[model samples]
Target chain A: MKNPFKFKKEIVNADLFNNDLPLPHSEEYPDEEVIFSVKDFQFYYDNGEKHALKDINLEIFKKKVTAFIGPSGCGKSTLLRCFNRMNDLIDGNKKEGEILYKGTPIDTLNTIQLRSKVGMVFQQPNPFPMSIYNNITYGPKCQGLRNKKSLDKIVYDSLNDVGLYEEVKDQISHSGTSLSGGQQQRLCIARCIAMSPDIILMDEPTSALDPIATLKIEELIRKLKEKYTIIIVTHNMQQAARISDYTAFFML
Target chain B: MEKKNKKINLSYLIERNIKNRKYKDGITNGSTFLFSLLCVVILFLVIGYVLFTGANYLTPGFITSNYSQSSVALRTPKDFVYNENDYDFSDLERFDDTYYSEKWGIGLQYGKDNNQNQVIYLVQMSENSPFHELVRRDDGTNFNIPSDMYLSYITVQTELGTYKTAFSEDGIENMISTLDEAVSIYDSNFLTLGGGISTSLITTCYLILFTLIFSLPLGIGGAIYLGYYAKDNRITRIIRSLVDMSSGIPSIIFGLVGATIFIPFVGSMTGTTGGNIFTGALTMTLILLPTIVKTVEESIKTIPKSMISASLALGASNTETIFKIVLPNSIDGILNAAILGIGRTIGESAALVFALGTFITAAPSFTSGNTTLAVHIWYILAGEYPAYEQACAISIIIFCVVVVLSLSTKLINYLFRRKRER
Candidate 1:
């Protein structure tokens, strides 16, 4: 007779407490204000159904990196989507609490205007099937900027800021998808930035990437938080601990 | 005792092997292979049969000329006296005297005299060819004239002094000569820009244009409503079911409906009674709309919800997201639907039969009567004389055109997909 199950080896936790900071670090700028406030928010897929998120209250400050760390299906991504009303696309999806961006109700605001102000990067890199130049210029063009010079400048500035400029600047006609996975992910971030949105939400942005690319994106997030309000969802605890100023832990 | 234990162990091992193997092994049955082979065989048979029939009728002259009845019928004098008894020198002088000219000297004549004393002449114009001109001699003898018998005398000279013969006795030969005549006549009479082909071409193009005009936007709009705006309720389910079922209904029924609905409405509104391009287009649109809607709806459904989410998160309205992002991304799918709709419209026969009648006339205006390729094929098939081989040739032409269209559509789709991926 053979044993029903075999032992699958588990590697011990390496790099433990590597990026964790000592508790109670002082704020870099104490004068800055909180831009987003969520109060006792609960998300439900149906009436009296399984609660995806339960009585969660949180704040996202301007020019700060706030991260959510959780296991699979723990509703961390769901809470992130609340800031931009991304949950509205799901049928029968309801929320029980309030989300405020700059003291105004998120639900009552025009969805289009709110989305323009709050941009998001998905876990999977989804660059439009167009030229690298077009990918960066998509949002700006959608906002009705038609001048070639203006578009060129926006493409240049956005790519430069994302550190992908030298690799792609000369190959303007190349496809956006032709880039390396790390570059495509960075291009998505650049696309979010090119919109000039005040808030940027990232949903496990580097989960699909290799280690070196993941490190680059983690570092880039810290630099991005200097100007834009940032909230990132990550399954990797060390990533949340590395760049996030405030970490929210969640469990399913 | 040892032998008994070994036998039990062997039985147990056999049962274990049977249990471990699942039912879905990868072997294919004979029936499936036979059925697949049958389909291929049937397709080849149809193609071979059509080609065989069509080749029997097609000749170079048949393809290029117009029809003339005078080419085949026997010529007889309106008034001539008949001799009752003689076979040889009886009508030979009369035959030569009446038909032979200085250029057409000594035309060959042969055939037996009938009891009525009428001479049936079989005219042998060329020595080795089946092309012979038949002339009726008064004594019932038939004469064969050389193919050049008539053309030899029909000479015209230019200033350069070169004689040009305008008429020939052996009208283009092989298989079905009358159809060859019809093909030539159709081309010469209709296909020229100011003639038949141009008029029919413009009518078809206009019909296609109006069909797109009436069906595309409405179909796409309906698709968007069903795919995006309509809640997944009983009403939507019923609407979807109805559209799906309508596609299964025969096209002829739609033709009948169109004939009853559009012909009278347009006829009353415009104060005219008869066929027109506009009426045909309306009929085609009704036939095409359901197909377009179903195709476009399937395409819209393939768009990921996250794309819409991303757009909405940026504060784009449903309409804005749909128009700006969804539609642009799904352009290939929309184009596929449109091409298929056009192909369906072009090939549809039964619907056009009732909506646009069988008369092959040059349409001068939207209100004028016209016939399309499929309608012409139908008329050729069902005509009083029943031109079978000609109909087969025309069908082959239509089949070739459709094959080319479908192939180009596939090629365009491939290119668009490659460009989109890039």
Candidate 2:
């Protein structure tokens, strides 16, 4: 069998940095693979009167759990939104830089297509006002998948992936909003994974949950990296060190 | 002594302030409560008066029969007395009165006038008695006689006997025979005194159906555009304000517009000279548009923006989002709009009178001039002798229909909300 957490050894004994330091020039991995490369990225708000992100350069590895940890107003969430152009929805916000996804410019890809490939889960448990089963199947149905047998398999697989199938198996038809805050957050994660995206962007997915629920989500994140490349923005430094293969600290 | 006196004065002032505030509150609250109670009482009194006056006349016959007035006089020959028994009065012998009148015998005949029309008269057998005329000219011109005329019945008069006569247009026999003949006749004028509102009811139903069909889609579509699609800008603000202002315009103004615009437009298509139900429905569509649009737009605006964002994030198109999420969630508003439209259509008299003329037809067609229930009531009241009884009956029917409609709409809204909650 192959070890899924092979990159854990690189960051286990690493020292936490206190300030914005330049990238190290050491060659740790000779065969390292990069999934996303941000080059000279700059983000502006209020039609360029305010600078939200300035000259950001980062590289995310394939099939690895990468976390962005920073204090409030450090633009961690803003940078995560740029991965799939979710920032385009905001009015009068501007971006000037190239964000490459798998060696292809993200700007070249269609927004709907990019979102389908790189799904997102929000901080708040914003589950749709619908049943659990319907919430899991919403993405597939939007892509025009009509076969019932396949949809049922996808719903079961997605729910089981997030360890929610056991607790909500009998009540899959109940409203998604009826679940507890922790369960709702997991359901949102399950909803994001149901689209079978290559990369999953989670913006503080477990901040609204209890300690036990947070621990469970961290464990799920450690396991999910075997199949998906994960990028998470978190305010908790301990959580960033526990589950992430690589951590980037942003300064305000 | 000074400190004690100050404490007493402070306590007294506080007490007076509380008492004055309570008294003011009581006055305002009591007046508002009394005003609301007065409104309820007035509503009940009006409904009670309508029910009391119209309940007796709202029979099945009144609802089904047509409007008509006919003049027919039938009399029997028992009223006459005669001295002679040997008389050639075989034509009148078959009547019911001939067997009972033993002392009198009657002779009946028809004569031809100058215009070759048959006129009926009676001959008495008693000596020195003048000829009795059953149907005669007011000029008293007796023409030549026709011996082979049809003798249906006869009439006779006597000195000290009561006569048997029948003078009615809506008698039992006449109603059945008229209804039977009405099936074949298309344009027969109603000649009976007692009439019904069957035509007006049918016209009203047609008007309601067409008005709803034409107005709902347009109104709802406009609402969707204004609520979801239009950007918040100067043009949109102006448009919304215009819609709000149009709702306050009097219905009489709409009547004039309908008369000038809709009637002529429909006349060109249906080839009608003046007004019809189609024209009325078209005019009603315009009148109902602003109300439905405003209400449905407001309801759509009340929906949480998160729901819209959720749908959009799922890659659903704007049109799909509107059809699936926004419209389904706002079902209560759509139903409310429909109910209000129905109420307006039912109570609208002035607009329909201009778009659909007030002439009542027994069998009204789509292109025919007709009257609705409100217009019928108006016509009844506008007559020289106001038929308040019939007006009250129609008003009662309208009231019941509007109440039932409003109740059902509320029931539908409740069920929808419950389903959504589940």
Candidate 3:
């Protein structure tokens, strides 16, 4: 008799629709092709007892790698999560100001559509408890991609893109969490990529990995920037300098 | 509020303190060991007493035979043949104390009857035996010897002479030899009495299956709602506290509920006027839901919050995330719940007595009221002539199932951990 969904204010519909269209005024923005524009964006937590981010202004260009580097508790990851509205899940967390995705406010777009295009990877590699193939296909399958051939292609291509194919190609049906910490992060990125998103956000993805794996992910990021716009938050200054084309410093 | 100054003790002299410390340690250590030893001893005492008493009565006939007795005064088979080496009793496990006639293919053992009075048991009857071919004397209807039977009286009429003996006045060897030499056996066995628990064992199995069938889904659903989706509020808190409290209530209260609610409800479909196994199963479901939910909730809670976020971040809906991520992760706990439910269902009694009557017979259907192992124990012990040994025998059977269930739980969890590790 006690229902949990009854307490929820938002009913999320993540179904695919045929009405999605391309961004408006794309040509009017000129040659730079600014992917996301944050103007006076401020964030607070715990009913404003904590001000996480304030008056932040930044522009992320298309097919470019931008990094947010700062000391701890500076809301770098907070701002990154705000891009996909991941912070919307928490209770009593308030946000003021606006973020524009390709000259259109992100709030106007459907949450499913917005998140489909703006994918994210967490600080710790948290793969869903499932086989590698199922883990990679979960998002696409949810949106009704049922063609077995295409699903297999998506799985192979995404794993290959992150350079994890060579290591885990034989055990695609194995559990995703069984992989090493480094391989798990790469699998998380591959899972995000399997959705074919336009942007990929990584929050300290390599923090838990060894240096060799970090180098591989940095190399993957450099190669990935040619096709997808990336926004990463990291405390490693050299990592920001090595991988990111544009860097912004964040503070509490 | 006023604060009192507390004195903290420090060892003024380390060497002097060592003696005091050793003295206190000895007392504490001895008491801890003593209490733990007491716990182990109590466990073994209960198990050993039950096993020692019950093991004596736990025969194949006691486990696999019927609960009631059926008697036939006269029976004759339409096609009767007595051939040499017609059947062999050599392969059968011999009760050394039994009188086995290899020529007639019958083994008769001295076992206690239903009332614990010493009687001759018809332990074995191989194919083509005269007993299997015999017919009722009064009505001339064929009466097949049940695999499990007791020898009340046997009469043999041979070409040489007529030999007869009652169970009480048996030179069993002479009677059986006379049986082997018979040209025709006459009204051989009369009044096969009941002592076995085949009905109760089967009833326990059915109740366990039906109880799990009804309770697992509800328990898992409640656990998922509380673990993944529920808001921490007064209503949920109340529901949680109720679940905890329900597990503590006596099983008899649940039996009363089943009697009041489920008996009539099931009776409508089953056409049973009294308490039935289905009603008992419903009661068992009510009793087991709390354990199932609690274990599942504990496992579901152990799943990292990041996995849920990761799924949602990948554009999967909350529903999709739960089915794929949360449910799969908590499978070990669900299995554990099922095994625990089975163990509880086997050992349950008081509630089942109210929901299912302690009438052990041929389980005509789930609609027919019958006793489970635990309820059978209660029925036997509750009588004026308490059959403690029989009750203990039933206890041994219940304990076996529970032990096997618990061991399988451990095996399943181990396999799960190994799979996850791989």
Candidate 4:
């Protein structure tokens, strides 16, 4: 909800809900449609005892790869999670900022709807303990897609897009975790793609893979760039330079 | 591998290492082995003794038969002969401890009555007498007469004279030989016979079933609240502590609570006066809730946190995630809770003594009070003539049941893990 009223005296944890507070543009970017704009954002952990991120400002261009490369504990992953409100699941989490998704305040959007449009892949390859086909269809089924044909198409297209269909075509019904580490990583990406999200968030997605797996996922990301806007946070400078179109550096 | 091993001089290093710590290693190793062996020996010894003593008595009838019997006075057949010389006790049932006389056509099967009094038990009458009617179970070859009847007196006729002998006299056996020659054949006293664990076993089974019926939902519900939803706060911590503490409380306390609260509550609905199987079950539900909640919560905790995140990220609601993932995954824990309930309920006697009375009924009904297998042990052993053999036999049954439940729990868990892994 966009709140109009604001208290002169700030109440702890309640100040961020004063949604009508305006933010001035501080940085210049190309005239492309800004898919996501972070304005003076601050993130805190341990009930505001530790300031994980402070005064962060950035603008993401449509259908382009934007990488956040920073030292450990600089809250790169925290900011990525904030885009889909994944941080809300954490206990004692507090944030003060304005984040807009396609010019609309992200807080105003339904979380499930917003997350359906903004998919995420974690650092480690964490596929569900289920068949590969079921893993891809899980998101669509959650969105109430009951038709078998549509789900099968989604599964086939998603796996095809991630370059995993050929390798796992014969064993698509095998347990997702039973695949090799890199194959599992690609499978996770395929799972995210099945939801038909507009933007894909990768938080050090290849950190747990070998060199060969890293190269494969990087190539997949470049091909996927034509369809989905990609925002990745990685500590590997070489990975950012090789795969990302624009990069932002952060320091503790 | 051979070249690497040749360079290391493995034998020399091994000899040096062993010599330095040989004394310390030997003492510790010997003590550990001896202690473990001693523990295992003690365990097997106890079990073996129980099995050995109980094996001789563990018959199918002993388990399935009823424990209580009623005695009755029966009359001789209209064509019964008074010939003592034609006495035949070949078909008479035999027991090792009791004495039977073929000439008298009578037997003292189990010497002691319910009152623990040593008395002469009447077994058989004439070949066609109405006093000793037999009805076979499964087969028509054997018969069990209702027993425990007392004989006030008996009139016997011999060559010397006809004399009246009271049952308590020392010369009662001398008079029993002439019992068939008595003036009135219909003046004999009859006895009731019964002793088995079937009723108590049935009661325990009913107790486990009904208690689970009432407890699983509540226990699992509490577990969900504690495992999935509750935050780490003062209130939640207190609630968790209370649940843990409740499991440690003696079941006897729960029995008292049942007697005061649930007994009246159940009695109001049932229209009975005091505690019965239903009330006992209600009390057991209370005793088992904490155990079930803890086991269920622990199982729920075993689920990886990532699965929950994955489910939520897929746009599944919290309730959906819980029902689809957490509950299904935690089934092993739920079954374990039921097994724990059974083992505890079967072995529970102190609490049942209050919730369910010490009375052993032949045909156990939910409306009236009856003892379970455990309470049955307490009943017989608490008496003057303690039936240790029967108690051990009952223990063997309970032990086997517990072992079977434990093995089944393991098998079920293995199957679940296998299915999940596959």
Minimal lDDT window, size 10, model 3 chain A = A10-19
Once model 1 is optimally superposed onto the true structure by TM-score, how far is the C-alpha of residue A49 displaced, in angstroms? 3.0
Assess every candidate by TM-score: 0.73, 0.73, 0.85, 0.77
Q: Residue B311: error of model 2 in Å? A: 2.0
lDDT of 1 by residue, A1-252 (tens): 213267333322222112232222225445557677788999997543768999988777777888999788999998988888787666567788898777666777666667777899998887766688877777777777799998888888888878999888778888888999999999998988888788899999999999999998988888888778899999888888898988888978
Q: Which is the winner by lDDT between candidate 2 and candidate 3?
A: 3
lDDT-better candidate, 1 vs 4: 4
Docking quality class, candidate 1: acceptable
List per-candidate RMSD values in Å: 14.1, 13.1, 5.4, 8.9
Q: Model 4 segments beyond 4 Å from truth?
A: A1-31, B1-38, B71-193, B412-422
lDDT measured at residue A2 in model 1 versus the true structure, 0 to 100: 19
Our model 2 lands, by Cα RMSD against the true structure, at 13.1
Q: How does residue B271 of candidate 3 score in lDDT?
A: 83
Off by over 4 Å in 1: A1-32, B1-28, B56-205, B363-365, B416-422
How well docked is model 4, in DockQ terms? 0.35
Q: Better model by lDDT, 3 or 4?
A: 3
User: What TM-score does prediction 3 earn?
Assistant: 0.85
The positional error of residue B42 in candidate 3, measured at the CA in angstroms, is 2.1
Among all windows of 10 consecutive residues in model 1 chain A, the one with the lowest summed lDDT is A14-23
Report residue B118 deviation for candidate 3 (angstroms). 5.4
